[model samples]
Target: MSLFLEYVKIKIKDFFSYRFTLFLFLLIDIIYIISLSVPFLIIYSATEGFPNWNIYELFFFTTTGIITSTLIFTFAIVIGLDITDKIKDGSFDLLLLKPVNIYYHMLIQSLDLRNFFPDFPLFLIILIILYPLVGILFSWINLFYFILIIFISCLIFIGFSGIFISFSFFVPHFDSFWDLFFSFREISRKPIDIYKNKFIVLFLTFVFPFALWNYYPASILMGKIDTSIVPSLVLMAIIFLAIGFFSLKYGLKHYKSANG
Candidate 1:
């Protein structure tokens, strides 16, 4: 844990050490979030609003999606790429020999210190604005559950990436997995119900479990989710994490130094 903390501290120091990089990232995140909101703004203006949703409601929805995406990207996609890059350069071989668990080694090294500045501030700002309008119970217990759900979503995504990472050990062409992952991620960016397709909704919500990232939890606040569905989502997350763990263990046996 100390070594991991050192990695985090170094990332934080580096983020502040370079003022210009920090500003650029800050600008990019702001612009990206603003631009992405345009479609929702247009829909709100044209139709007045979606049924049971208003401009501010949609704003909260999209903002929450952005925060979830950023958090997942920081932990999963970013770390997955770091693993890929290290594998390509054969640097991962040294890390594999370390006393640390390879999973933890991969997870901690991929931390993107730069993204925290942009994503977290925006998350807080949106959260503060939407708290009153979210229509939840608004108690400390509720708040804790909400935060826990989002954290679980991050675990689900990291599990997904960990499973994807396992492929590199067997498959020569593995980078394309990122594209497939992103395409799947696009589905979770909005309320899964908006699709209007019952099969897709059920599959995503139950089978693939992408909705664990935002939809299921967001629906809890919207007063739309079924109480019975909550435990199932958490169970799905645990299952995926286990799959990722066993996959890595199996994959490691076949791993050879990239140089060899």
Candidate 2:
């Protein structure tokens, strides 16, 4: 944790050194996140709300998705994209020499401060705005579940992105996997319950598990499901993380260094 904090401090210093660029990026991040919610706002205002979902509930769902996506972008996809370049340049092997846990080192060192900032703070602000509407339902238990869900969501995201990142070890030019990954993750923008097809719902829930990133957690907070389901969710997250870890390890074994 201290190592992570040190990296964060460095990233903060570097970002602050260029105040104007930081401001511009922050502005862009805010605009991009807010733009995603605009469509939901339009839909809610224009039509009757979805059967079980009210506007606030849908807003919470959207906010969770944005947070999940942004956290993934900052932590995993960016590092995965960088890994391809590092492999091509024969710098990927350097990670093996680092004293820290390789996965932890990769994630901490790849901290992209700009990608994280305004989006996170913006979400907090949105939640603050939502408090008046949701305050009564915001029990300590709900907050605990929400935090747990977010932690698992991030793990699931990293695990999925790791699969793509692992390809870089075998194929140095595999950066396009991030684009494919992003396209799939965009499905999280809506709750799976809105879909009518059972198979599609199952696929989204388990195969890609995009629903975990937003819908399941949001539903839990909205009291649509019992907390007993959390254990299963935790187990699922671990499974995904294990798969991603092994995939990357397998790729490493197959890797032929660019320098060699």
Candidate 3:
């Protein structure tokens, strides 16, 4: 645990050492937030309401989705870059020599605080907007569901990222992989409810599992779906997490040192 903490500390120090780079990344994130929110705001205003949803409900659902999307994006960029760079430069060898698990080491090395400043404000703004509708007093049950949704969302995204990054073992060029991954992010940003087919929803929620991140919880909270989906989401997260871990392990076994 101490070693993991040390790795996280080192990662923070390294990120801060390039202050200008950090600022640029944060600036880009802020721009992205505005770009994302503006469309939803415009559409909501133009329509006078979200289809099948009132103003307050739309605000709450959009906010929740944005928060989860932001967190996923943050982790994906941090973890993806760390893995890609290490594999490219062969620095991953140094990490493998450590007593700690290599995946854990990679995760710790990817930790960055820069994402918080931009994302947290957006998250808080959403919360403030929703407070009037949901009331200041939160039910413990709702809180539990909220936290669980966030946790599952993070796990599902990071797990998918891990699976993507592990492809470095087979594919020497990760630039294309990253491009593809980011393309998928665009789809994730919107509520999956836009897809009308029940089969598509089932595939996204049960198979890909990204829908569990924000959509499932938001649907339940907004009274669009049943609370029963919560347990299923948890199960899907665990299954995908396991699949990701196994994929990484398999990739490691096949990994040939760059020198070879």
Candidate 4:
């Protein structure tokens, strides 16, 4: 635990060390957030009102999606890049020699503070805009479901990133995988309801777990979906977690270190 804290501190310091770089990243993040929200904003304005969805509900989904994507982009993407370097330079072997779990170490080492800084203000802005519209009804059932949605979203994002990074162990060259993953991430920013096919939803929720990230919760909040979907969302998150861990473990077992 102390080691982990120290690692986090070092990461924070590293981030502060590059002020210009940090500013550039923050700028990029702000631009990305604006770009993501614009389409939804345009659609909402064009429609005057979403067929069945209200402003509060739209805000809920949009805010959650932005936060989820921001975290994934900052944390997961950094780790993905680091995985390639570790595999190439044999630093991963050095990590394996440490007392801590290699994956945990890698995860901690990949931490960056710059990505999260912008999200705080943006999230606050969203909350300020949403609170009056949604009202604090405090429904226990809704709260439980909301928490579950957040949990599942985090798991799905982490699991997807883990699977992507693990491919480095087997593929050696992962540029194509990275490209495809980025493209998928871009697509996922849109409301999942945009996809009309039930099969596509099933594939995303059960097979990829992307639906839990923003779609499932948004649907529920808007009253466009049933509460029964929560179970499947939980199950999907668990399944993705299992798959990610096992796949990474398998990849590690096959990793011969560049020297071998």
Candidate 5:
């Protein structure tokens, strides 16, 4: 925790050093987040939105996506990218020799405090806006489940990212991998039920499991589904996490230092 705090302090100082750049990026992020809501508004304005989902519900769903993606980008993807770079330059060899557990160390060291600052305020704004529309559904137990699912979803995303980062141990140049992963992640932004094709829905639900990111949890929180599914979600996270762990270990076994 001390090490993590030290890294956070460094990041805070560095972020403040370039206040203009920080604000510029923050503005860009906010704009991008607003842009994501445009499609839903346009669709709803043109026609009835997304079968049963109202505009506010759709916005809620989008907010959850923003939360999940923002956290994943800050915690998982950034660290994975750093790990990839270190692997390419052979600096990962030194990272392994550090006294701390490699996973915890990399996670803390790669913490981009900037990427996390926007989500809380944005979420609060959304909650305030949504309270009138769907506030009746809110309860402490439901909120707890919602938060728990989001936490597991973040871990699942991190594990999925780990599976991709493991490939860095083999290939020297795989920078486009993150783009490919994000491209798939885009599927999680919308509800799977919107797709007419059963096969595609099943594929996403089971093969890729992107639905866990927002759909399942959002559905439960919104009272569209039963909470009994929480156990299943936890199991799925465990499966993915275990797969990611072994994949990383396998890649490590094959890794050859750049110095060699």
Candidate 6:
């Protein structure tokens, strides 16, 4: 944890040293947020409300998705893509020789501060806007669920992204895999319950557990479901944990130095 703090301090120091670069990163973060949100904003503007969820309630889903995606982007880009770059440039072998648990080491590695920093302001704005709509239901338990769900979603994001990048060991230059991975992750961004097809809703919810990112917890806060959320979350935590650990071990075994 001290090491992680030092990494964060360095990021802060770098942020000051390169003000222009930091500004550009912040600008890019804002633009990316706007781009991803415009379609949802348009839909809300046109209809004024979704079928099952009102605008304010849907904001929960929207913010949840944004938060999770930003987290995933930061985690995956910092670690997965870094690994990819090193592998391509023949520098990854050095990383493999570091005397530590490689997976655990990567877990605490430096994070992209800008990736989720901008989202904090937007999240504050969402809370202000939703104060009236959610004030009545804002109890301690609901808040606990909200925080727990967000934390678990981040873990899932990390695990899933790590698992996908693990494929890089077996398939060099796997450009198409990233396309498919992101496409599949896109499903986690929307309110899956609104779909007409119940099977898909169920699949994404309990089966693949994509809904755990936003939809399930958002709906839970809205009183859409009961205690069933417990087992579903437990199952998801297990699945992602296994995938994360298993992928790290398996992928590391296939690792060959650039010289080899």
The candidate scoring highest on lDDT is 5
lDDT of 3 by residue, 153-203 (tens): 888877777787678767787747777656654554556767567876776
| Poorly placed runs, candidate 1 (over 4 Å) | 97-100, 133-137, 258-260
What is candidate 6's TM-score against the reference?
A: 0.82
Alpha carbon lDDT of each predicted model: 0.73, 0.75, 0.70, 0.69, 0.76, 0.67
By lDDT, the better pick of 2 and 4 is: 2
Candidate 6 off by > 4 Å: 29-33, 36-38, 44-49, 76-78, 108-110, 133-136, 206-208, 258-260
Report the C-alpha displacement of residue 130, candidate 2, in angstroms: 1.0
Q: For model 2, how does the per-residue alpha-carbon lDDT over 60-157 read when each residue is reduced to its tens digit?
A: 77877777667767876677767667776877788878787887877775657676776777776776676567533767887789779878877876
lDDT of 2 at 204: 71
Per-candidate TM vs. native? 0.89, 0.86, 0.79, 0.80, 0.88, 0.82
**If both were scored by lDDT, which would come out higher, candidate 2 or candidate 6?**
2
Residue range 148-260, candidate 5, lDDT tens digits: 88888777777876887788887668767777766776776788788778986776666676776677767778887779878877887888889888998788777777521
Ranking by lDDT: 5, 2, 1, 3, 4, 6
Point to the candidate with the largest TM-score.
Answer: 1
lDDT of 6 by residue, 1-260 (tens): 68778887887687668888767866786787678667777998887656776766666677766666567667654567666556556676666678977765665553666665656566657655765675436667765776677677767756766675567666777545666656755776767766678887877765556676677666666666664576667668778868976996788788765421
Candidate 5 lDDT: 0.76
**lDDT per residue as tens, model 1, 1-260:** 78888888888887889999878887887788778788878877788656666666666667767777678778777887777767666787878788988778777767786666767777769767886776556556445556677787788777777777778766665777777767876776667777788987987766566676667666666666555666766787898888877887887777876531
The reply for model 4, stretches above 4 Å from the true place, is: 13-29, 44-50, 54-56, 73-77, 88-91, 97-99, 134-137
Candidate that beats the other on TM-score, 4 or 5, i.e. the better one: 5
